[model samples]
Target: MKAVLPSITSDLDQAERDLREHGICLVSGVLSAEQLADVRAGLYRAAKLDNRRKLAHSGRRIDHGESNQHVRNTLSLDPVFADVAEHPAALRLVRSVLGWPALLGNQSAFIAMPGCEAGRLHADQGFIPEPWPTLPQGCNVGWCIDEFTEENGATRFVPGSCRHHRPPGEGDEEGSVAAVAPAGTMVVFDSRIWHRTGENRTSDQSCAALFNWYTRPIYRTQENWFLSLNPRILEGASDELLTLLGYKTEGFGKVNGRSPM
Candidate 1:
C-alpha cells in the first residue's frame, strides 16, 4: 500500500492548521505493513520474555499472563522500537504541535486487551507538581500498532480541550470523540488535553506505541529511556536522532560547564 503522508511543506502547513482547529490530528499510514509487522513481532517477543521471567519466579499458573490490566507491554525494551519512536512523520507532527526545537522525553508502548479497564482521564504533565493553567509543555504520538476502534479501546480525546484552563469534566462530554484509526496510522495530540484509553470489547488485544516529546527542557519523562540507550544505537543515530533522545548541549549546559576562554 502507498504511504499516507503529505509532502514536507504541505505536512508542515497542514499540521499547524490541524493543531489550530483540532487539539489532535490523525495521520494515517505512518508505518508500512512490513514495518508494522516488525514492530508487533518485536513487542510480542518482549512480552513473552517478561512473561516467562514472571512465571518462572512466581511459580503460579496463569492464563494469557502477557496481557496487563491497562497496558499489556512496553516497546522501550525492544531495540527496533527506537526506530518507530523516531519516525520522520512523528517528528513533523511534534514540530507542528510544539512549534519545533522539541526534545524527546519518553518512549513507550501500551497494549490493551479485551476486558481491560478503562484508563483514568488526565493530562500527562499533571503528575508534576505545577501551577494550574500551565502552558502547553509537549505533544505525544500514539501509533496504532493494532486496529483501534470504539469497541476495541480506541483512544478518546476532547477536541480543543487544551485551551481550557484546566482538565475537562463530565460536562465536557459533548465535544469528546474516540480517535479510531487503523493499524499503521498515528494520532498526535497535545499533552495537556484530557484523554483516556477506551475499554476494549473485542476478544483480541489492541496495541499502541506511544512516543512523547516535550517542547521545554525541564520536564521529566514517563519512561527513563536514557538508561536503555547503548553505544551501538547512539553511534548509528543521526544528530536529529540524538537530539530527540535527550542528547543536547543546551539542556546540559549547567552540568557540562563552560570552558575558560
Candidate 2:
C-alpha cells in the first residue's frame, strides 16, 4: 500500500530523522478508543455550536456553504481537545522540530465536504521570506477523526520536500502522495513541507481532522489566545499545556511587565 512513514515503530532519533527526510510521519495509536470517544463528543458539541452560530464570534470566518469548514480557536472551545494537543509523542516531535520551549501556534478542526478543491500546494513558512532560514518555524499535528483515505482529502503533500525551502513547483504535485492512515493516528508534518488538502471525490461524504500547530514560541499565534480563551477552561490545565498556550510571564506573552506566576 502507498504510505509515508507509517506508524513510527522506531526510536525518537529515527523519528526525527524521518521528519527531516520525509517532511512528515504518522504515529499510530496516539489516542485510545475511550479518549477518542471523549474528543469526538466534545468536537461534536463544538461543531454543533459552530454550525448554529456560524463561527462568526471566534475571529475566524465560517462560510455557510464552503467546502472546508474550519473550527478555528479550538483550544478555547472545549477540554477534550487538550488531550490531543498535549500528547507526548506529538510534543516530543514538535519540540525537536521547533526547538525547546515550543508553543502552540494554533489549533482547529477542519471538516471537508466532498468535492472540496485542492488547497494551494505551499509551505507553512511562506508567511516568512523565500528560501527559509535554517531555524524551524513551525510544525503541524493533525488528529484524525475518521479514516483518512486518498479520496477523502487525506492530506496531499510532496515527499522529501522540506529541503525545498520555498513553495512547491507546479510539477511537484504530480508526485504528491496522500497521507493514508487510520482514524486514531497523528499526522505530523514540518511546516516547511509542501502540502494541501486533497479533493474529496465521494458523494454525500465528508472528512474531519484537527490541526494542532506548534512553533518555536516567538512567532505570533494565528489566534489570540489571551482574550479569546474562556478562563474557565484553564481551571484544570497542565503546566506544559499552560505554557504551550503562552501562560508564562516571560517574553512576548508578558502581561503589563508582570510574569506568569
How far is each candidate from the true structure, as Cα RMSD in Å? 6.4, 3.1
Give the alpha carbon lDDT tens digit for every residue of 108-160 in model 2: 88777787777777777778876588655889998888778888877777777
The lDDT, on a scale of 0 to 1, for candidate 2 is: 0.76
What TM-score would every model get versus the actual structure? 0.79, 0.88
Q: Which sections of candidate 1 miss by over 4 Å?
A: 1-12, 55-76, 128-134, 169-175, 213-215, 254-261
How well is each residue in 60-164 modelled by candidate 1, as lDDT tens digits?
A: 211123333222324345556767767887777676666545667766556666775566677755654545545567787877777777887777777667777
lDDT of 2 at 154: 76
Q: How many pairs of residues collide in each model?
A: 0, 2
Among the numbered candidates, top TM-score falls to 2
> Model 2 misses residue 243 by how many Å?
1.4
- Against the reference, the lDDT scores of all candidates come to 0.61, 0.76
